[model samples]
Target: MVATIHVPVLVREVLSMLVVRPNGNYLDATFGGGGHTRAILENISESARLLAIDRDPDAIERGKQLAAEDSRVEVVQASFDQIADVSRRNGFEQFDGILFDVGVSSDQLENGRRGFSFQKNGPLDMRMDPTDGKPASEWLNTASVQSIATVLRKFGDERNARLIANAIVRARPLSETQELVELIDRVCKTQEVNKHVATRTFQAIRIHVNDELTQLRQGLRNAFELIGHAGRIAVITFHSLEHRTVRRQFSQWVDSSIPARMPIRGPNKGPMKIVERGLAPKRQETERNPRARSAMLQVVERVQ
Candidate 1:
């Protein structure tokens, strides 16, 4: 079967805000489909070096292929949160541009065995790095009702979090995505219209299984440290939770609200400035890629 390739969203905006540099070091923290990486390469010079990192083995292999084709690219198999170590380990102590495309890819959703899509009947495994961490099924089947409910509420904002959690506990050992989807449908007592009732639950489970939010938060801090003066950090978030995290972090990094006070370190990390508060895909781009509909880009640059 031909796998669906994930088209990068807001390509023009990302390139504009990020690759304003004239041949400088760039990093793609989540090289999902290599679309953004390719776009960056096209905009950069022959002397410029770009590093792409991904936790997914499939993406890493694709990155390796791209690296082979282009000597300017270096592909690494690591989580985005490990940006600091990964960067220094590969001789990239600082960067002119950094991108964090946060969320799952179309390829993962289309592949049933990856267990990220509610429509697919794959095993309930949602770890971005399948080799590491426990599967979603293992957590869902074993976690307490309160724990499950908390994750649903915190990550997915599922209104019926407690109700769904209770139902899941009653129907123990959900091994398949369809099984969980059916359970959520029965509990919600509704059918899919604009969006599936199981969508939020699946997202919550996936996020919890992968510790995504924590990874993103840490990745943001690491990116802030790794970015050079005037270097831009652009983040494309797919969910409201991720949007909030990026916005709050960027705001704190800028700290525009803080009064004139001592230079003691608090939430305000110096040398960062906000470039783009919130940028969404244009109508034409959204039409071509529906996944870009919910995407929001936030950019911040370091200014010494």
Candidate 2:
């Protein structure tokens, strides 16, 4: 028997920000479970077009099934970081709107084969682009202990990162999810055992393997460039790290400054402006979809 899948964190909020011209062009950067994509297509005019992108091949395939009947929706297999290239190649020269539902999907977490969950034991592989990227297992085996600890501390904010890193290093060449979980459990002194200590470690590893934070930075920048005048960009970030990146990037876009200077270029002066402060899901939507509980939606529009 198949279980039901919950739609992602801020569907309604995203729709409110996007879906500008029913006939306008839109892009779904994450395309996880096609929840937002289906809604956008259903509500928009027949002429409205959607370009959905996902690095995970499984997500791309799933989106294909959801969009099979909608000729207006184009599904592409690629990371959201490649937003500019994908949009250009697909002839979406400039978009009316773009939505980024960042981070992992429920499909990946629940599906043990993807190795994203602690509920079901699986391999430690967490590459979103499994075709071209290195898996989490390979990284753990090869990374220095200090590097591991830094990722755990920076990404996961795991308090015992040093100890966890030491434990992981001692257990060299760890293969499965359970092995890492067990190693973390062993090193942790607390007996409460409320949840797996490896949860944060796993999250850190997944973020590193998938290059999620970096992709988000680039994707947002590309999005700012790709949106047409008055076009909107909606981002739904699940966790604190993802939220922080979105917040910082959007904040920079709002104030007309770059958060971090890059050698390639300095801040671009533009007419982009934050239309409003961030919004959260409604009480009803949150109740209906538990995953929506943590979602924070922020919108920005290109102003002339």
Candidate 3:
């Protein structure tokens, strides 16, 4: 088997915060390459069970291999929004700990064929699940300028959203990462510090193609629904929007005295309390895996 490209960011923090109980059931919502999943398993007991899910079929394949090796591990091929169903089907009554390492996985980003980055220059397809949705190229080739601009602005926070959108419209049918990267360079002359010029554009396109934000929202609710009282949820997000969404929802749950709409379909006992926010990776980790530099972990425990 090929080695996993993912290095598992914030490993020490996630293991300490999320795996509060050594033998409790847990869930790893994004089992990319099984880094975090393996850590969870090692940290827990032989009696403990872990449900590992990822929308990417490659990740699922890796997960299945791990499941075959470890009896306590249960692998599921499902998106974040489908996690609850998979968990129920897998026979989890409720999770003692739930974790989400949100955003694109290193497995996807490093695979040139996945088209997540232009460094290797592959197809323009950016769907997390290549089988489920249309490719980014298909959307870019057909979407209106206004729609593209909106996606760039909202998802990428691109300063040159309109200009890039216009350029993309003119350069329709972009089928490769290099094509889009060159176009982005031509239109947006300025680059983000220490980042590629195509970063925002690729991010926006990938997010749109995968319907990531919507799925994240639904997934957060599903996590809440599946967490038992005192159970904690740890979310490691790489994007500003993703971080904000998690913080806001967690804050709402903690602030409200009543349950309000804070569930999926639960006899939700009460609000969720925050355990940590903006927890960063150790300097050693960032030095080893630069990807960990921008990642942050937030944790909240469901209070009954």
Candidate 4:
């Protein structure tokens, strides 16, 4: 078996904010490698309970191993978007703290078979839940040119989305990772650069394949609803769009009143509030884990 490469980002900040109560109930929305979950458990007492969710099968297996000796830990193999359902089924109406480490795990990027990284040669598969979401190869092979362009543009902020989409369409049946990368390289005119030109294209496809933004939005709302008053919810986002979405949603939830559209509509007694401003990892954390460089952590609380 290939070794997994998952290094938790913003570990200290997450532990500091999410594990205040040793016996408190907590939720880890994205249990990538169980790194954050393990850290939280270490900081808590025996009575503390942790409920974690992961969409990846491999990650679920890893979580199983992590929970082998800890009966307090319950690992669920499901998307965090269904947090409300999962929590209720597990007999938890509310939690003391909730944490979300959004975006792909480092392990996913390192695993070439997953086709998440353009740097490696593999198939064009990039489904977080291979059992459900469409693969990148399938989307690229079947999607309309305009739709492809739109996804790349919206999700990756790719400027040459149209050209790239056309090129991808013209070069159909891109089954392998190299074929897609080479084609994108030709279209984006970044072949000379060391970085792969298909990076953004792949990211866009993955985002579309998994409905990541929507899941993130729903997961945030669920966290706000399922966490008790004064309970803190911390989210670590990797990209600008994801970070912006979390920040905006958290700000709305923490200021004035909860949005009407949010499913977790509490009474009009006034809005829940953020305990403090967003927190970024220390320079030392970035130095230790370069992946932490782009991590932005936003924390909110239910003031009511």
Candidate 3 per-residue lDDT, tens place, 189-219, comes to 7777888888888898888999888988999
What is each predicted model's overall lDDT from 0 to 1?
0.88, 0.81, 0.88, 0.83
Off by over 4 Å in 1: 1-4, 191-193, 257-269
For model 4, residues 119-227, the per-residue Cα lDDT tens digits are 8888889988888967889989998999999999999888889999999899998888888888877777644354456767888988998899999999988887898
Ranking by lDDT: 1, 3, 4, 2
Kindly give the number of clashing pairs for every candidate.
0, 0, 0, 0
C-alpha lDDT of residue 144 in model 4: 92
RMSD of each: 3.9, 5.1, 4.1, 4.2
Give candidate 2 regions above 4 Å deviation: 1-4, 191-195, 256-270
TM-score of each: 0.93, 0.90, 0.94, 0.92
Local error of candidate 4 at residue 225 (angstroms): 1.5
lDDT of 4: 0.83
lDDT for position 30 in model 1? 92
Residues 85-132, candidate 2: write the lDDT tens digits: 988999899999999988888888888777887668888888777787
Better of 3 and 4 by TM-score: 3
